[model samples]
Target chain A: MQTELSGQLGIERAVFGFTPFPAVAAAISRAGGFGVLGAVRYTAPDDLRRDLDWLDAHTGGRPYGLDVVMPAKKVEGVSEADVEAMIPEGHRRFVRDTLAAHGVPELADGEASGWRITGWMEQVARTQLDVALDYPIRLLANALGSPPADVVARAHDRDVLVAALAGSARHARKHQEAGIDIVVAQGYEAGGHTGEIATMVLTPEIVDAVDPLPVLAAGGIGSGRQVAAALTLGAQGVWLGSLWLTTTEADLHSSALTRKLLAAGSGDTVRSRALTGKPARQLRTAWTDAWDDPAGPGTLPMPLQGLLVAEALSRIQKYEAEPLLGTPVGQIVGRMTAERGVQEVLDDLTRGFEEAVDRINRIAGRSGPS
Target chain B: MQTELSGQLGIERAVFGFTPFPAVAAAISRAGGFGVLGAVRYTAPDDLRRDLDWLDAHTGGRPYGLDVVMPAKKVEGVSEADVEAMIPEGHRRFVRDTLAAHGVPELADGEASGWRITGWMEQVARTQLDVALDYPIRLLANALGSPPADVVARAHDRDVLVAALAGSARHARKHQEAGIDIVVAQGYEAGGHTGEIATMVLTPEIVDAVDPLPVLAAGGIGSGRQVAAALTLGAQGVWLGSLWLTTTEADLHSSALTRKLLAAGSGDTVRSRALTGKPARQLRTAWTDAWDDPAGPGTLPMPLQGLLVAEALSRIQKYEAEPLLGTPVGQIVGRMTAERGVQEVLDDLTRGFEEAVDRINRIAGRSGPS
Candidate 1:
């Protein structure tokens, strides 16, 4: 396929979005595009190490990246115990009551379901970074904020490029200023935490602001035409996150997967602060509705809100709650109706990209619309 | 300029956004574009007539279009008086108190500040449509909904093509089924009322679903690269609304103009239902803050919310209150730092399109990033 993003990654054009599973990541890199493994949810360094080892063994030296949820707005000197202590009795009771009302049984003594290991805090993410750099990773991407200059320096020392997600051109500029090698200009329609700017506008603005530094267009990007559109917006490549949620290689919880598959349309996702205490877009469910209701307890700031809801997320997964289960998804979730292997999805994407290019080339000499 | 949209419009690739002012509409047409004047805000037929007369005198036979706020979700049958009655006393008091706190003065008796005219009610928009068809408009675009079948039939009989804005591929299919000549796939980041999907993903999906039927990519579109991106998304053209707010020819209320110009970045705007009851993206202001605040009374629905906030908008405009005055703007507002004439902006757009094409042409057959 004739594309800039593939050229940048030294791969053929493929379905290039994020997937949290190591198997999917390895398969993606082998398929021709970069597969980024999200390490934020790994509570143990051994788990992340083993995952990276599995990827290294499977990919046969194919390049991939590791993503960590490193936020620019850091909380200094707060221990996990302090954070736990900060959770109000009323809020704790609310979580317990809500789960109980949903017929979710409590975990047995010594059963591991604590949300504290999600690695959202700066301290936890730093350890995850240690695990990431140990692998033959080509890139290290930060999710919510600029990578610390020291971390950028460290990544460069290892000859690994650093990437960060920016919701606006200004944030992209900040990312560039912080020595980020790549800026992923994620828009409002993206999974996880996103900014208000749409990808169509934000991608080009980021490209302009951080010229010479590559920009990967995120948010609402999945299909081959969307990748072509991102290139048109001056992006080096396109980032896909939510598209992979339905992939066979994805590690989606069964209940969340069911809810995603049965989603009505793109309108099913809402920008709710209930998840992780940030305005992340996710499929609307009974849980989200309860949290967003006026009579219900409102959300707290990042880490606090996420800390508060971690038990509920665990219970929902443990109980396999259907209507209450949700996942961070883009509006593009509607297109992900069926399960497909990573290579199959990539094949379709590559074909689509080439076709879109052909479609544009056909109109090269044409003046305007018919 | 060598572009498909330009050839389709029988003009050069030039200004391709919204036309809120008669001068802007006339200037856009003169600058090699098909400018569609937004008539939803005109409370009086005479006002719209005068605007059309002005356009006719200035356009030098160039064609233009008219846009009205016809929403698909109809309010059955309700008079303006009935809508007025539905506005709660509490909501009215909140509006009054908020405006008074901002030191915004009241509008003079009988002076027109028509928030009522900009509602999505079928009855309110039909009157505006009647005024629009009286003019020599070539296109009639609806803002929120499908144009009624009878209205579509009538417009087709007169050879005046009807267009409707769709937020999703399903909505586009519906528009096509209802016989809309053009489908404007407006993304979530678009100004005014928009859906959750971003333009990058939404545009191509809509275009694919409704092939041969022209799709205009709206929301977060303004810059040259964005137009190219939209075209890449398989859109016939781009429809921008926020880009015109700072143009020299645009009829922006001065306070809004200042706020728009001084906007720091894309993060400044918020999608709030405070102004029009519908979740339209606008520059974040104290007014939006109060409505979004949990301590304050929450927003009402459609016409009632518009009615409640009408007096406050009038006062803000009357007193030229910069902090309180907000306008429907997309995330692209950050890029609009300076005011330029329609022709200057159009020249930039044309040049940018060519430059983008050249950049892509250079990428053809390229192996990897430099």
Candidate 2:
């Protein structure tokens, strides 16, 4: 059904569905290539199963993917409940008091669901994986590290390709060694948990190190010339994440937020762990500034940090008044001025790729068949 | 006495000297990294010989080097008569007509003698080379391409290391194949002729491609982090050019030009072929704009294009009132805010390099011995 992406997923233009909304995922699948639903927000197995079913019905079985944050290294094997318990009483009080101070109401009695990042979290991820396997998902990607051995084996058993995101060539090699199918070399220019290395240097080094394995270049790729340069440096396909976040189909908070992104340039983005408790490239905002302030309490670990402010973040999104609510976005966001449909975006990529190929060939002095 | 450029030349720092003046060439040889006079505007052999002799007298018995343009491909041969003959009378008339339209006067009868790229230009370059060789020059660097085979042989016979400027990995390979001793991978951010690739990408690629040959990363590197990044990416050393242009020792045209450069940012510079009929990055000024204007007479090939506007450029420099007369400078000019001595500049680079090394090692978790 999807000819472009079916042969080699790396060659396909995959639109990452960062939202948990099934409709958005389906729309991306309909546009061609795969769509990936962010699975961290979904709590229950049934809730995830429902979303997966909704996506299948809406897209008529177009292949999509599922993404989860299964970090390999943490403080220890401390269970989710144990980690929750480990959070100091003062910190929890601070969160509640801060929300109160900010005019955001606290959850009603018995509505408070404590958040954690441990074995229970892993179990939830495994359960979601189990549910997603029932559908026609062509790929499954993990955000932080190599998927657990069982997760890889189960996906392989279902004939689904497993891919992982890596910040460096060393990380990419570890993924390849672990039998991962594709390595997404995500550079510092990328949004969401990036490294210090810039895209220009990282891409070629990753490509050279991970020979024979299909690699996708992910970073500040917003134009055809960049895509062409990536291919010239040996990437099989380019993975675009931030470029999609600003599209017409994107479920942004409000018009003001979108306008802020439009006004920003490539240099405006900063890599800070304010939101995710990991170095993630995001638009600089008051929230980031507050976290960055030396006087404030430092950020906590992954899921713990995310859990602490999830409700506050929910309020921020609901109000859409604060300019600091925008999520992870790459440096390429500077070039994304107008809102366009996914199909239009794909067409632009195709045109850019063709032009870049032509330019490169001309420079190489090879006009036709040798 | 020179202390910074010791490894390249075999003299002690006390014996050699490094200065901003062209005469520093002999001082550097007396102290040690064999200082070479920058020959950007030296059009006559007599002018160059006079400077060379002045250096020779200033630093008695010190060896130095001579740098010149020997581009592999130029617009035309260097014989003054042949080049003048080759310039179509219509083109000359057109240039005169254009200058007249701009209310500029035509050059006086003998004033146009030094203009044009001719075989005699090569003869002038050889003359300077021979004059330097007559003294004890330890090196001869062709600022554009591989030194002509005979030129290389002459330098080698005199025990001088021959070096060349390369803008890409392919260009570096060409220099290596031609038996050049050193390959300087100058990135697009460089002030002079450059390719489209940035230093971050070009440095490592050139380092990897030209194995066994020491690579010096040049371009937009004005600090320690950049220098560290270059070495981390496999460069042996850094060949700084733009950073020197704003130093207290630098012989600049006007305070206004220096101020404009100081106020610019890393992104202010643009790579355009407006100056030398080849892509050379510079502060985008009116002079470059006039040539870049799509409606204007398009730039001619090297030497031809340069020859066409030589007098106009000289006038622009002489008047110093035209914004179009901005000199060539790299993106690093943005950080070149304050005036500092050459020694201070060297110290800053050393400090920056140390900090970068420390930061990178800390990130890699290898700050201490394994």
The regions of model 2 sitting more than 4 angstroms off are: A1-6, A9-21, A73-81, A89-120, A368-370, B1-370
lDDT per residue (tens digit) for residues A110-159 in model 1: 88774453588888898988888887788899988898888899899999
The iRMS of the candidates, in order, is 2.5, 15.1
Please state what fraction of the native interface contacts candidate 2 reproduces. Answer: 0.01
Q: Predicted candidate 1: what Cα RMSD to the true structure?
A: 3.3
Q: What is the Å distance of residue B60 in model 2 from its true position?
A: 27
Query: What's the TM-score of each model vs. the native?
Result: 0.92, 0.52
Lowest summed-lDDT stretch of 10 residues in model 1 chain A? A361-370
- For candidate 1 chain B, the 10 contiguous residues with the lowest summed lDDT are B361-370
Taking the tens digit of each residue's C-alpha lDDT, what string does model 1 give over B1-370? 4345456556655245567788988888887787888887777778788888898788778778888887766666677888798888988899888887888877878876745545356776777777777778788898877888888887888779888998888888988999988989888878888877888778877888899898888887778777776776787777877877788887666755565555646777888998788788888888899999989999998767887787778778667787877888888888788888888988787667656655554444422222
lDDT tens digits by residue: candidate 2, B1-370: 1112334564432111222367335434443334666654566667766877787676556566656776555435546555545556665665565555556544566665332333215655666676667766666777777778888888889888777778767788988888887677787667778775556556656766788887766775666545544544455556666776666656666777777778865445667776667888888876677677767666776667666666666555544544655666776676687877655665565555444333322222232321
